[model samples]
Target chain A: MNKYDKCVQYILNNQNHFYRIAYCYVKNEHDAQDVVQNTIIKALENINSLRSIGAIRTWFYRILVNESVNFINRNMKEIPYEQQSIFDTEYTTGFYQPDDELMQLVLSLPNDMRTIIILHVYEQLTLKECAAIARIPQSTAKTRYYAALRQLRTGMEDCNERK
Target chain B: MNENKDINFDKSRDAYNNMAIPSTLDDKVKEAINMSAGKKHTNNRIIITVASAAAAIVVLFIVSVNTSTAFAATLSDIPVIGNIVKVVTGRSFSEKNDNVTINVDIPQINVDSTSAPDTAHVTAEQVNAVIQKTVDDYMQEQQSVIDDYKKSFLETGGTIDEWNQRTIDLAARYEVKYQDDRYLSLYLYMYMSAFAFTQDNYYYNYDFVTGRELTLKDILGDDYINIANQSIIEQITEQVNSDSNAMYWGYHPAGYSGTDPFEDTDKFTTITDDTSFYLNADGNPVICFPKYSIAPGYMGVREFVIKRS
Candidate 1:
């Protein structure tokens, strides 16, 4: 009926999988939903800003990543080092489908290295897409992605040897 | 290694699809969009400019589920450093840093009264009780925030009496001069809390003398409240600022946003007439005038705006 009506239907229909994908990054469902709400709100407000269909998910995701970073930054002031097991306590829910051991290993990597793994392997965005989404040069993304994979492999191997 | 059991990209994709985003968000989204329709289209409203409002899809799980526990632990272990570290660095002080020495000092805010309290026998709590009572009364309306603050205060090994004691201790740090009949420190506290002659009703006074606290009622009572309301009505004349929108006569029940604290006190004899000035300029007060009519604990200057340069 109207611009908002059409967009609303589109979002409602396609929301399920995207939300779970958001969950994989943010860990908390509420935060994921908050990120998504901000995302669609951005999309609606700047509808005219969009020029193509292919750009939709990445553009939406870029907004989510930015918001998520801000959320973490705002909350970082409240976190202490002693509660490192905080996430471990929360992971009791069977909702997580990521390779737990591998995911933990990947998270252990420095943030830059972890960002490369999350963008390329987990999100399944291509090299070009990853670079564009991360706002890094293509070569930089390529280098980081390879380094992240090597680190993940090394971590998994170390865990296996310990076992 | 079982190739299929190795939770590959394809299996992850299936699970991702199975987990649904909350469907209840539609109404909220619609409401936000509709309300923002005019503002966002023209870019007049302050849009989500800071990247904070946007999504940075990599949701790190650092907010650890035991957030409240950590917060609770912080209160008991590290008092000043806990607030300071969180304040300075945009990060919470880790529990490991709980080793920082915590001085169990009373949280005394400074209060510069006109002079040191002359009554040698009276304690700080007696002076602060006037302000604290009004705050306790105001919190009757702010029930929710009050409960939270009170709970936190109790949790921090703080008793209700301590807040007043601290306030008085803070005020004592200042010199409370007695001018005509009123205490200057107490008067300044009341005025500041009342929003500097214009706003009153809430216990929002921050003691500029020593960062102590005071309440509006501690300084202004019944007659003054009515006078302030009259003054506000005269300024806005017939129109008043309502909860939602500004409306003319017969719009709302409680006329005006409570009371206008600056209403001329020529007709009122409660405060301005009796209370002696102790702080800055010397003269008969016009606001809380009538030397005998003023109540104890209630104090303010009479209309002195006309006398000063």
Candidate 2:
């Protein structure tokens, strides 16, 4: 198959990956779906720019992340933690039950640090890929990741003590 | 980390990991793909035709749009055109009661997709935070100044009424002097009195593809500092000697007698990596020097336009 066919097939098969990444930013199913759809269209339109098949995942992730950020910046206001719902339990089930307190703490972080945590801890990308996607230094990415984890740990301790 | 902490973190990650993709999404993407097959061809045609007319039309459109009340908010929303849109929009937090009056004009940077994908994703919050902090800091400093003046007035036997009558006016205005697909130059003007007026210029250039901020070294190689220094000194000398009325705060035996600031070839050693610069339309770097730095205050801010070989 040609590269276009391959890209389409890859996108089709990995719909969950795209939706989840988009959902992290929009925090809603419908908006996330719209973001994913826009990303797919943009990706397909600019598919010729994808230089190497090996770099397609990072390239695709870059587009997905950019689309997600753009969507959030355009549509969402600064919603306080009290107003933000950590999990939409209606859509997700089984072993994917979100830790509400931890998720809330994660969402409360500045966008840059939050993105690092999402890319590192949730998306399971390598440090190098996360840095490249974020357009930041590898050292900066590592620093933010550790800082986020530390913040999460402190948050967890507070929750446990309160309980 | 302990097992419990790991469990909680893992669960949070898994929550997003199992994001439910809508059953209809595949069909939608397929539809979009098929739709774009025709639209992409038409888009290319439009781009080709519009490319020439863009320069004239873009300026006209941006100037009109900048006057709109919601321009700042909407500018951040424009995506994928590769141009920088700037509009001065902010609520007047300026206070004018008794002691002093402060006027501030906050500016916002708008990124279209064509400029760089990285910057296009920059949120209104990120850019606004910078402007807000700058304005806030200036306000705080002025507040202290007013307080100090109030204390001194009362100490010198001036009445509260008399102190109240004394007023100092301070204003700050931000201007978007230059912008294109590659570079953006913002000038912030702070006015107190004629001698107290100051202008600061900020230049931002990004890699067209990555949208990452570029520095002088990135464009000018390892010896960028030396090269920039040499170019600026040569430009200054030419301007001071050749120009009739122009003068630098440097020595010329034929004219003004003072220590030659550029005599030491290490003239630009003080220019740090973070020195402000902006590119002109022809892509030449203009080194922006603050007022009273390289020349007398009468000369205003000095700019050295470097013509790279």
Best by DockQ: 2
Model 2: per-residue Cα lDDT over B1-309, one tens digit each: 442355357667666665566665654554444444335434434433432232234234334334433533443454433445444565455877665777877776654445433533354335455556555665565566567867887999989987665556777677665565444555555554211122233343433232334567766778888888888777776775676335454433253422443334313344666466776666667777654345433345578777776
How large is the interface RMSD of each prediction? Answer: 15.2, 18.1
lDDT, residue B258, candidate 2: 27
Q: Which stretches of candidate 1 lie above 4 Å from their native place?
A: A1-10, A51-54, A80-83, A88-119, B1-8, B20-309
Give the alpha carbon lDDT tens digit for every residue of A27-120 in model 2: 6667777888788879877875676667888888889889988876664455434233423343233423235667767766767788887777
**Model 1's DockQ?**
0.08
lDDT of each: 0.40, 0.60
C-alpha RMSD by candidate, in order: 25.0, 27.3
Q: Clash pairs of candidate 2?
A: B80-B113, B80-B114, B81-B113, B81-B114, B82-B114, B82-B115
Q: What is the lDDT, from 0 to 100, of the residue B260 in candidate 1?
A: 20
Local accuracy of candidate 1 as per-residue lDDT tens digits, B196-274 = 0111111112222221232223444445445544543443333333322222222222422322212332223233322
Deviation of model 2 at B242, angstroms: 3.7
Runs of candidate 2 with Cα error greater than 4 angstroms are A1-163, B1-80, B83-95, B110-124, B158-167, B194-208, B218-223, B243-250, B255-270
* Per-model TM-score (chain A alone): 0.75, 0.81
